[model samples]
Target: MNGEGKVVCVTGGSGYIASWIVKLLLLRGYAVKATVRDPNDQKKTDHLLALDGAKERLQLFKANLLEEGSFEHAIDGCEAVFHTASPVKPFAADPQAELIELAVKGTMNVLETCTKVPSVKRVILTSSIATVFCPKPPLGPNDLIDETVFSDPSVCEENKQWYLLSKTLAEDAARQFAKANKIDLVVINPGFVVGPILQPALNFSVDVIVDFINGKNTFNQRNHRFVDVRDVALAHVKTLETPSASGRYIIVGPATVTTNEIEKVLREFYPDLRIADESEEGTSPLNYKASVAEKVKSLGIELTPAETSLRDTVLSLKEKCLL
Candidate 1:
């Protein structure tokens, strides 16, 4: 359906990617019902309200991913819903249970609410490339994963990899439910999102970038599938409007790069920054170890170069005093 004049509910609207989605929706003349965990948090909603067209088109609602029917009020009268809320943590004590429950249950809850709302036609879910690519080597010299590849939850479960398992199951459940209920669902699976962070609140994912710029030794590995935040957000809006778009769309930048490459660019761009050494032993910042060219090409999206993406991210962080 055309987004103009139709209300769209964006879950986790205060988040990094969701915030951009809200901004674009408002800019495109769509009424937005943004759902956040705490509606009273003026710091979060204030910036959105201050954006152009937000005053007349934006509405904030308090909702929780774990709560049943919490999204019903926000989704009412909306033609589409962007389910971008998911528990994203570096480590979790009960990763499997918490991530799985939140991902699967939260998706079910949102879709359940959509069923009740007659106006709802589409649900754009914010999935990740983690659901498609496994975090291991030997993906072959030229192996690039796409929407057709689904992460083997069994492998993830054996390794106690809760995050991957959670995403896999969540997207799977979303697809199954959408088919049964006849709801049009479009899923965008993005790689390590790198772009200008709009909010001052740093997410867990951004911490890695911060560490890289600070010259932390723990992240010198050369493995990751990076994507620009703007591209991911733009893909979300495009998928929502594109009639031919269906199923999963893997949104990633041109190609993968190592942490060493990332650090070199940062050091070159900002010479004064505390750059990390390659000798330092630490976890790799690169999340998805696969290619996303096919999925992006299918959507006719041209990914931003890794150099440009990293440069923009560092510049943005410097401007915000995050560096």
Candidate 2:
């Protein structure tokens, strides 16, 4: 797992978490083949190139998750593959089918390509905490979820259900395939990923942060596990090197807080900024039940607190002029 001369292909190089993965890989001295939907887009690649060490080690390649053999070229000679490219849209027109297709097919495509190449040793999948817990209330006060717990797709129906279903099916597909093919797979199930936005664009998760900062919602009772994107990226890197880091790891922060709590922190830090009141009517974007401290810590990961993580996120957004 020496990254000095290793080649790593990061799917969805322009994405929020994937970009961080690519940056960390480059920093670790790995020659990166970043797969984008379109490598010709200068705007996207420009920001990546601006990062230190990216100029020499980074290589952008155009590959679609849906297309067969699309990732084959990008993955050639790669020793490790970070599959962080999965649909995050909460409300897709066909959430189940579309998510399933991308998650299962895309993973299969990556693994198939790995089989074609001799260098690939491991694949780190960016799964979500949603894959480990459901939106509904757990049975007991101590009903904390772990890597063993999986989101039940049968319970998923529409709208929000689609995203969860997709994650569940996709992760399940990966596990099944890994067992069958004996592919070295390490799954990192992170909670609501909150961190400084790498790109100027607002990604799917950032909509919640934007809504809170823009005074869009008013209720504050909901709570869920949250984690810093930087920490999650670090976990991916650690899992890559840790040969024993097989199976699933729940990458969550030290604490869970509601949107209202986050808003209060933002208002306190930036008094001039207008913030939203806690909302009571709308559905929560979080799954507050999942708690996998024992499991994640087993991998030697100490999560940052939610307050610290959210504060950093807000500061980052403000610095980037997004606030």
* Model 2 poorest ten-residue lDDT run: 279-288
Runs in model 2 with CA error above 4 Å?
A: 96-98, 135-139, 158-160, 218-221, 272-291
Model 1 clash pairs are 215-275, 215-276, 218-282, 222-258
- Candidate 1: misplaced stretches above 4 Å? 96-98, 135-142, 217-220, 272-291
**6, model 1: CA deviation in Å?**
1.6
For candidate 2, write residues 91-196 as lDDT tens digits.
Answer: 7677546777887788778877877888889989998877766644443445666677777676665435777777888888888888888789999898778877
Give the alpha-carbon lDDT of every model: 0.80, 0.77
lDDT per residue for candidate 1 within 140-232, as digits (tens), equals 445656677777777677667688789989998999999999999999998778788877767766777777776763445546557888888
Residue 43 lDDT, candidate 2, scale 0-100: 66
